[model samples]
Target: MLSYAGIQNPYALGKYSVEKNAKVMQRYRFIHESLLRIAAGHLPAREDWDIKVALGKHLYEDAEAADRLRARITELRTSSAVLNQEPDAALSLLMDELIHARNDLELMVGIYGVIKPALLDAYRSHTATTQQIVDQPTIRMLRSMILDLEDQLSWGEQMIVSLQQSGIYGDNGDQFKAGIASLLAAAGGIDGQQPKTAVLPHRIRSHEPYRIPLKSVRDPRKMGPVTWARTSVLNPPEDPVQRSLLAKMRVRQEEMTAAELIAAVLFSQKNMPWEFYRDLARHLWDEVRHALFGQAALESEGIDWMSRPQYTSDYDVNAPKIPGAQYAWLAIGIEEGAMKRPGKAGEFEFCRDEAKHPLMTQFQDYDWADEVVHANLGRKWSPDLIGEDISFVREIAKNELDHFWTEVRRAQAQWNEGAS
Candidate 1:
């Protein structure tokens, strides 16, 4: 049977011209940039653990969305110059206020309550109005983004409710969101298609631009300055097999120290290609996942993971001492070692073959896969940030890692002596 061409369909293309579609994407791209920046900038200072993880994931998700839009926009036009420019100043102002969120409460309300929901709406509107057949590629890209945005919105909404129950999100939540709404109103909404209001709200962040904090803060549960790997004093397991399992889990949970450093690098390093930020965002999120694996493993054994000492020292040493570009190269260098024989691969084998532990095996399997990707990303992009000499980058990275572990050993020694 022959399928009828355009059965029960209107012959007319939908509303947008190529130029108009590109403009809409530009607006979305800028908003995604704002989302990425806010998530990365506030990560170091955001104290809530769950929220911190959400930010790690969201930053990467936002970067992916923006990168997709950038790709689509390039297809729509000749020069990629338009992707680099801000689509609207009022829009930029709105973003500035959003990122300047004074506390976690304000951050949640601004991003979840106001901006992201608006962004979701704008995306839905564009998808609905654009010519479906002519702009099929864009429509496909946006469909995927919309699914992610919806999931993110649901997560954010639940987080807001949790905050409200804890009494952190109060009446001021409405007020803060209103301020953001007014800024968006002045900017003519996320798509820049609405009527622009000339008068703008008094800028809350007028005092100074938001500065990315050099250090990340954690909840009260985080006890640190003690290195996890070198000493078994804090997380001592009696049985040999159990001790080995817990030891590896500790490594995974402490992966956050690495994630925190990556977040700092993303925020501090500027003017790199968009690909750098995008790749680092994924790297940061992967480290967070590794940390969660460790957390979960410990908890499964009826252990209080957070109650034990966390390793805050890795981030402490490198974040202050090194430039972001150098820090990035250092991370890539570490991952290269991690992918080798005695690292992730060996860990996976221990879990699967020797330990006879299915869950830890699963964890190690994915952990190995993630590091492979991270190592590949490092090899591809590290040279661009540092120099083309791979061996030199590796040497510098090794020395830095060695120095960081040396300082960690010294701290552990003093701690052990004090305890004794």
Candidate 2:
């Protein structure tokens, strides 16, 4: 036989059959969905600002991985209809335990220390066994997923360490993680191919169903009133220099509400297209990044943002309402309004010209750019999700915004009266 350039041996083929590969892909899909669920579920409940931000970013990555896995799975023997089907009952139960983990430390130990590393191993095993030339597409997909998973695991490890150092981990934290690991072992590990040596562990989900938070949680050390941005003492300083400082502080602290609202929508809405979730997840992460930008800006000025109030009203009011209404209000009204004059661009120019702060100018510059994308994201997804014309959604969102500001004003008045 003539030699082929790509083959080690002309007669040899890869180890896994088509059916086997598809099953592996299904397992990957399930892991990714669980990742999405874990991150979205915790975004509102997790109090640490950095942890919340990290969850926002991870959820977006989870959504992306899930989307890609679906495409690859569809190309296999299975139909698209089976894409959402549960791969294994035990695996499903395992996820329930992770989602219902007692606290942030336990959740960290389960997800990062156990599930994620196992997932990475499964991906590596598949790639190593599969034929590279014949299964190039799957190989490529797994490669991308591996990169993202590695990055997430890196951060997850550091975060776990930070949690441990802070003395937050309960004495039972390791035992809790071990119980979860034993459950995974009973479930046949991440790939569902390992021996079921251990029996199912006790489940937190059994005691109580996991409820997504109705409002965003803030760290007690950093907690503040929802009126922080509205109060002149905290924001909108008369001095230009202080104005820029406060603006960054406002963004760093206040955008948590945006993240909380977006996560609420992702968790609550089930009927929207997968693309809607992906885009909105990205939108959620962008808001978190913007908040981080504000954090960085404040750090540059030796200001402790935790010393100031982080606003919660934006999440508090909308979270309990219909998610559709919240989405419409934010995407259509506030974000679109931000695209106009004296909004993001105006803020940028103020930092550049009046404040003459180079760091603030750069921060606002990107802030303006991000808002432009968010405005378009609102236009693209909000109308379809809300089942209304864009104009009508805009009008409705405007009314909602008006009502919100009215409440803000009323609260401000009460604060003033109390002081007098």
Candidate 3:
């Protein structure tokens, strides 16, 4: 018989029958959903680079965890559909409160300090209570998650400590502490109680109206307002004779980053499948990395990225309102346009042969690969949201791109006139 030293004769059989395992898996599924909701709600609303990247990383990890939990349920021969259902009412409320936190500090404290600790405790108890031999797979999964969560907790505590040292919260630390305490109490004093079934609202309420200002961009230092210019993905350089390949690459990456970031924020605001947000968040983070690649390249060339005059056109500015499937299609179109004939492949080839810069070649190669994946993602998700008419979607994407360039030219003229 499967046994452990501490497991008594009565409990040696393990706490999980098939039904019990399903129930536990269901609870874990709810927890994963809650984490995803929190990540999606907070990430787009944040402006600070540190917070944004950290939250983005956290979101990606949570998404992976959620995916794993669903797979585990299926492995146990249980219906993974329970994952699509509403989470415990109290857990949902806790997530809502965290999402609605007035500021980043409050959010960090509530999630890392209170919610995470409670979750860690519950997972520990579950692992301990579970039969080590019979439930080895589940135990192994929870243990792996525990390691990640511990790292997350450490990072969170450091963030809170840093905030305290910076005097950002001043005397309000006690207030924040009390707020966390209250949430923990409501969540059944850290160990977590069985969540009651409560009716879910028709619409999820947001703490603030989501808006992406036309001129907003995240940078490390304060710089003067830069005029936005639209550039072509097909032809990055209007005059290859004047501009270096590295320069063109940098600009292209920055512009793409801007678009990706904006799309991520807009998509997060909409009520979509959790999987959609998860995939989008991962893509958003990759775009950030791409932008950094450009930033690094420029700095290596003794160029101050912040001082460069950048221009964005009306299409890039107002693309957020295009709505639902169209928004996704815009991204798909861009990626497809870049990856196909006369596309980014040309740029990669040029960088590899003429530029002779290994790093630039490497970046472009990976970028090309990523866009292919994104195009496929767009193909997979966008059609269901709109319909299966692939040609119609492509046409809409083409028209939007044309409109975008037209706005860019007009905006350029207006900017030049104002400057002169």
Task: Report the number of clashing residue pairs per model.
Answer: 1, 0, 6
Name the best candidate (by TM-score).
1
The TM-score between candidate 2 and the true structure equals 0.90
Model 3 RMSD in Å is 5.5
TM-score, every prediction: 0.91, 0.90, 0.77
Candidate 2 accuracy as lDDT = 0.79
* lDDT, each prediction: 0.78, 0.79, 0.61
lDDT of 1 at 352: 87
TM-score of 1: 0.91
Q: Runs in model 3 with CA error above 4 Å? A: 1-21, 164-177, 189-227, 230-249, 252-278, 299-322, 412-420
The regions of model 2 sitting more than 4 angstroms off are 1-12, 196-208, 222-238, 414-420
Clashing pairs in 2: none
Per-residue C-alpha lDDT of model 1 across residues 87-167, encoded as one tens digit per residue: 888988898888888777789989999888998888787777776567778878998989998998999999888777777
lDDT of 3 at 411: 72
For model 1, where is the 10-residue window of minimal lDDT?
1-10
